[model samples]
Target: MNYYKDNVSTNVVTSNCNYVVTVKDWPAFLNEYNNFSNTTLAAYNAAYLQLGGGGNVAPGVSFLLKFGAFLNLYKADPSSDEYMPLKLNQNNA
Candidate 1:
């Protein structure tokens, strides 16, 4: 599986079924994420146009900005109340 940011693969991991995989290149991943977060609308719009602009790209961009902002906040202070742990259901597989 590949984790992507700004349509670029940042990390790649292979898994079969019974083992755990760790992302060893955290710095590279963070760099890619920061790049995506700092992308300007003009750049995004240009890319969108190049991809055959058919739908409004504003909403997608807005979502990325919002999510990136939240991530930044969490990175700044993981102990902050704004950070919440997701509760996963134990019964679900």
Candidate 2:
């Protein structure tokens, strides 16, 4: 044990850190979240379009973007949307 410790490292240390988070406005926060979602969906659409829609891209660019953004927001809030039902309806068989 002594030999292993000596060879592995000269010393060991522990970390002590603290963090604070602030969210002042709920409505504003939700608004900004959808704004961010819009930007992200725009990027997704741009990427998909860049690839050039050929076949089997899995739905249209706009729907796919909204679906993806919904997933991310649902992760944060666990709320409702059209795609949520479809996602929850998975067979799992």
Candidate 3:
């Protein structure tokens, strides 16, 4: 089966071994995911350059900065899953 929303298309597949699964606008999802990833990477690269492109900065700080960039990108897209809080198992691992 196929579905479309906001001009994006999705295909659904099912079988005896599989449940009712939905892709939900795959092409648009990929495009948006790639855009967010690329933008975050670019921001991280710029920060690395500013920090002399070496081990001159703390790794935690660098990670936080890159994460902040990702948050900014997510904020720009209200429909993105990036805004969802991560769920972990009881083991927390």
Q: Indicate which candidate wins on TM-score.
A: 2
What TM-score does candidate 3 reach? 0.23
The lDDT leader among the candidates is 3
Per-residue alpha-carbon lDDT of candidate 1 for residues 1-93, written as tens digits (9 for 90 to 100): 255432332221223212112233556557766866799978866655544333444332333333332322111133232332222233310
TM-score, candidate 2, is: 0.24
Q: Once superposed on the true structure, which residue ranges of model 2 sit more than 4 Å away at CA?
A: 1-18, 41-93
Give the per-residue Cα lDDT of candidate 1 at 68. Answer: 33
Cα lDDT of model 2 by residue, 1-93, tens digit: 645433331111223211112333445546757766878787755755655353334333323333333322111112322221122223220
Q: Give residue 28's lDDT in candidate 3 (0 to 100).
A: 54
Q: List per-prediction Cα lDDT, in the order shown.
A: 0.37, 0.36, 0.39
| Candidate 2: clashing residue pairs, number | 0
lDDT for model 3, on a 0 to 1 scale?
0.39
Order of candidates by TM-score, top first? 2, 3, 1
Q: Candidate 3's residue-wise lDDT over 17-36, tens digit each?
A: 11112233456556656866
